[model samples]
Target: MTKKLLKSASRCIAALALTGAAGPTWAVESVKIAGFTWPGYGFWHIAAEKGLAPDLDIQYQTIEDPYESFNLVAAGQLDVVSSTAEFTPVGVERGLPVKLVAFGNLSYGTDKIVAGPGIETAADLAGKEVAVLEGGLAQIYVAMWLEQNGAAYDSVTYRNIIADDAFAAMIGGGVAASEFWEPYGTNTLKALEGASVLAQSKDPYWLQSGVIADGHYMSDALINDRRDVALLTMKAMYDAIAWWKQNPDEGNRIIAGGMSMSLADVELVIGKNGTGLDGGLYVYDFMEAAQFCGSAPGNPPFDQKNGQINDHWNLVSGWWVKFNLIEAAAPPETGIDCSLHKELYDSGYRG
Candidate 1:
């Protein structure tokens, strides 16, 4: 057995040996997690601060580069990572031993395709350089917009730039357009003359697509060797979301404090209002996500059909293939492990 499995067995034996005595004392499992500094990914901070999973030592590292986070997970340096939902297929195609275990939240209107001055339409961007975090959801979003607007997917040259750099490129007139989220998207519009949003994620097409979203990924080792820890970690995430629903102010404060972001900036993504989608993201509660994953029996909110995770996975895989990010599409089951959601639902976890 793996070291983690042996350790778990030992812990169980110890707990059984202590039956009918004082409360069993077991060693806390140390779960290392990483994510970029985004408000949507900050829920892990809430899970930590609130002590939702007391049995697990949640160590969350803020690594701005999500690709690095995935690298760490593949290298056995991290257990879980919260990141954009669309990368699982890419990871699978690259032979990374990482799988997306749960869908966290959806972008309501936080993500935008912003065009710089003199770029009036999709056709205008042809032969021009557009900025995006190449091999990411931003690239897919922009490509989708282009195709929908009668332009070929490869019409524009893609500059593989991060959002912050993309913002600067927009202001400096270095690129015709870029994909951005939250403060950067809004700020680009404010900073550049004639800059306008070409498309927002909250639109019916984008919402139904569910492409712009966040999720939790776990290394194959964690899911296979430390199943209990994986389940507990996933539950703790929902527990944090439940607490946030009840205490939005405190939760937002905690998120902002942990992320070193302004409260206003955090609110712009997560929202101050009690409604989850009032801000920029539609934070999925446990049950709603279960529905999306087809672990439960009902349609997800926003008119999304149940079991849409399969569709979303295939859709992203198709885009990755088109962009040459992956040679071919892998089966959705290879990248997504919805059994965690199913287990949680079977255990009567409603939120």
Candidate 2:
């Protein structure tokens, strides 16, 4: 290729990029994202290492806890985040400006309300102690499930506990029943021989239909603030998810390493309740999610009829209001902004 011809081709590509030809334009600056300490965000690591985001700069930071991680993103220090569906509303209330872009994975059968061998059924849990992280999605889900089954949710003792300490409490037999997600749930059941699933949060009940799973979140300000770059990042993430779906063995290995678990353990986690470990990214038609969530008010940011999950937020928020965790009436609505995801969807940018 002669220098002149090469230069001509480069100019054509540049002109096309500048004119928004072929696909959505990409931002030229580097993108910094705050990711949680979990395997769901492993795709970013893989995509970055594989040079998937060659056109856009990608930076990853480890946020050991979700609370601090989302807070930072809301503060505009980070661009992207990952967490369950239960958090979008919370983010909105806290002024985070985060939006659900794509889903990663739901708990499937990973989360559970389990009791030591003695407390067999949900009915038996009345008056028994149940350990859980207070004010989290898990607690509310457990409560709702109990209520649905005619169990006395208030009758059970609720203990506020963190994830790290949850295992110890369950194993040492400090709590009769406990609500938790995997691999902690797996570890607890394994460590306690007498433990039995009082209620499993399997699909279609506890964590599905766009309700309980790991979803990709991006800042609305980042997209509207930097449109070209946000679109490109979405393309890059789609590539990452498609890449993993095609290579589960390798993908599992990477995610397992990221999660500090053995590959077999990762496999077990994915295998929770027959859930398929398909590639984590989805490139749905722009209006598809609106159909899914009923958010299609005007082509973008379609209706997210996620009352099931939203109810959890209100329940917890009310508890907080009652317990003084937050102000009585101010719900955190600023934290979640779906406009960016809605824009990409409405723009028909699948890449």
Candidate 3:
């Protein structure tokens, strides 16, 4: 029999052997989960590859776009998605019935504002045309950078385009600068002679606030009907993190193959001890996540605070509202849920 069928059979036998009480003490529930093509999100693939949640039936897919993934969740075609946390407010405002269940990683230096040759500082960006992925994290990064650098929000021209297009624009001299992440930043610096990064999210000001973290969210339907499955799914994610910690090299290979990214690129994102890509992104382990979501009591080391997810959401959601990315900032109670991580941790889910 297939694994699902075998699991079902075992559960049925156990229930019958126990006098068929018809209680809530059954086996796992089938879950449908998806996420974009990012290293942090790819950890779910680790769960699948290692059979971490053998009792639960998990269906994971790769959906490149966050909006599309949430749309699927809204239509009941998907149960959960690992995506950028900035979209939580937008999803709530649009009535998507999704919740930010847990955070994944903090973009240490992945996102950047790259300037072409002859632009040395943030002030140089004044009056110059800059490209960004409008209505996405790029816009938010650039906006926050400009504001922090004593530059006016409208000091420069904003060209909204896709990341690849923005890269092309910067290379062709169509725009003086653009927001880029990962290989894109590496590519821009290599392709354009004398190009440099003016600002990045890794700085203490940005990193300490947890403004650019990735997240895993579940649909209301799944959280309501299959709460146990939701808990099991999260437990699998934590298990994957623990496994990756003890086996970084092998884990990177699995993630690279599963996400269709090069091993080198995967290393760039995962970085040793959260210092990858010259401080690109800081990968959060299960313990760190528990503290971040306020599910774990007390603050562990590593500059993280308990219950910071809601605070971070408030900061980013306010920015979204100010930039008109969403209609309004949604309350934390509407979407943020840290209790899931806490419950698993308390239950001794070290993995």
Q: lDDT tens digits, residues 105-211, model 1? A: 99999999999878878999999999998988999999999999999999999999867888898899899899999999999999998999999999998888788
Two-way TM-score contest, 1 vs 3, winner: 1
Candidate 2 worst ten-residue window by lDDT: 299-308
Writing each residue's lDDT as its tens digit, candidate 3 over 1-351 gives 599999999997887878655554646667888887788777787888998888777777898778899999999999999988778888888888989888788888888889999998778889999898666777788888888889887788889865678789989999999988887888999999999989887777777778777888999887778788888888888788888877777888888899899988888878644233444777777777888888877763347688888887888788878878777777788878777887788888755
- Model 3: lDDT of residue 312: 79
How do the residues 28-110 of candidate 2 rate in per-residue lDDT, one tens digit apiece? 57887766566656667667777887887788777767778777877788888766555665555555667765545555566
Query: Distance (Å) between predicted and true CA of 323, model 2?
Result: 7.1
Give RMSD to native, each candidate.
5.8, 6.6, 6.0
C-alpha-based local distance difference test score of model 2: 0.63
Q: Is candidate 1 or candidate 3 better by lDDT?
A: 1
TM-scores, all candidates, are 0.92, 0.75, 0.88
Error of 1 at 218 (Å): 0.7
On TM-score, the leading prediction is 1
Judge candidate 1 at residue 309 and give its lDDT.
96
RMSD (Cα, Å) of candidate 2? 6.6
